[model samples]
Target: MGSNVDNALFFLVSTLFKLAIWVLILRVALQLVRADFFNPVSQLVWRLTQPVVGPLSGIVPRYRQWDLAGVLVLYVLAVLYIYAVFAILDYRVGLLPALWLGLLSLITMTLMLLTFSIFVQAILSWLGPGVNNRAGSVLWSLNEPLLSRIRRIVPMVSGIDLSPLVAILLLQVFYYLVPLHPVLR
Candidate 1:
C-alpha cells in the first residue's frame, strides 16, 4: 500500500511538471507567432506564463515586437525540468543532451505549427478575399518573412504561390533528418 501511494505521488508530481512545461512552451510559441496578445484568452495565457517569463526577461532581450526573452525562458525551463525528471527517475544522462533534445523538439513543433497555419491560409484564400479569419492573419504574418525569401529565390510560376510548398518541405527535413543532439545519437 505504501509503495503504491509513493508511486501515485511520483506520477502526480511528474505529470504536473510536464503540464507546466507544456503550458510554458505554448505561451512562448503563441507570443513568437504574435497571437492576439490583447485578447482575454491571451491575457490569461500571459498571466499563467509571466511567473517564469518575467524573471528571464531581464537576461534575454526582446526583438521586433516579439517576446524572444519569454521563449528563451520557456526553453531553459523545459531543459531544467526534463533534467530534474530524469534525475528523479534515476536515469543517467548529461544535461546538454537533454537540453538539445528539448530545444529541437520545440523548434520542430513550432515549424509544424507554422506550416499548418500557412496551409490553412492558402485554403481560406481559395474561398474568397476578405475572409477576416484571425488564424489566417496570424499565418500570413508568420509566413511572410519566409515566403518573401522564397519569392526572391524562385519567381512565382504562372502566378501560383510556391513558398508554402518550400516551407513545408524544409520543415519536413528538420522533422526527420536532424538529430535531437549529436551525443544523444
Candidate 2:
C-alpha cells in the first residue's frame, strides 16, 4: 500500500512538472519562431511564463535570438524533476550526476519539441495548405530552416515534399541513439 501510494504521488508530481516544463518550452519556441505577439495564445503563453522568466531575464540575459534565461529555467526545472523522481524511487542523486541528467533531459526535451513542431507542420500541410494561425505559423517558422536544408539534399519526389520525413527520421535517430545511459551510470 505504501509503495502504491508513493508511486501515485510520484506520477502526479512528475506529470505536473512535465506540464510546466512543456509550457516553458512552448514559450521559448514561440519567441524563437517569432510568433505573432498580439495573438491570444501567444499572449497567454507570455503571461504564464513571464513571472519566472521576467526576473531570470535580467540575470541570465539573452544571446541574440536565444532565450538563455528561459533555457536556464528549463534546466533547473529538469534537475528538480530528476531529483524528485530519484527520491520517489528511494534513490539519492548527487549534485554532479543530477546536473548531468538535467542537461541530458533538456537536450531530449529540445529535440522532442523540434520533432513535434515538424510533425505539426507536416500535418498542417495536409489538412490545410493555406492555414495561417499563430500555432501553425510558429511550427512552420521553427521547422522551415531545418526542413529547407533537408529539402535541398533530399529533394521532392512526385511533387510531394519528403524533407519532413527525412528530417523527422534524422531527429528520431538522434533522439534514440543519444548515449543518455552513460551519463546516468
Report the number of the highest-lDDT candidate: 2
Per-model TM values vs. the true structure: 0.64, 0.87
Summed backbone clashes in each candidate are 0, 0
Candidate 2, residue 53: the lDDT equals 89
How accurate locally is residue 83 in candidate 1, as Cα lDDT from 0 to 100? 70
Instruction: Encode model 2's per-residue lDDT on 1-185: one tens digit a residue.
Output: 15888878877887787778878888887788786778777788789889998998988878877899998888899899889878887888999988998888767777777888789889988998887877777677667878989888997899999998999899988888765753222
- What are the lDDT figures for the candidates, one per model? 0.68, 0.81
TM-score, model 1 to reference: 0.64
What is the Cα-based lDDT of residue 98 in candidate 2?
88
User: Which residue pairs in candidate 2 collide?
Assistant: none
Off by over 4 Å in 2: 181-185
The Cα RMSD in angstroms, rounded to one decimal, for candidate 2 relative to the true structure is 2.8
Candidate 1 local distance difference test against the native: 0.68
Evaluate model 2: give its TM-score: 0.87
Clashing residue pairs, candidate 1? none
> How do the residues 1-185 of candidate 1 rate in per-residue lDDT, one tens digit apiece?
13876567667765675567656655766676677777555567689989778887888888876677777776776576557655666676686778776777566556656667678777887887767766566557557777888878877889887887887887778766766543222
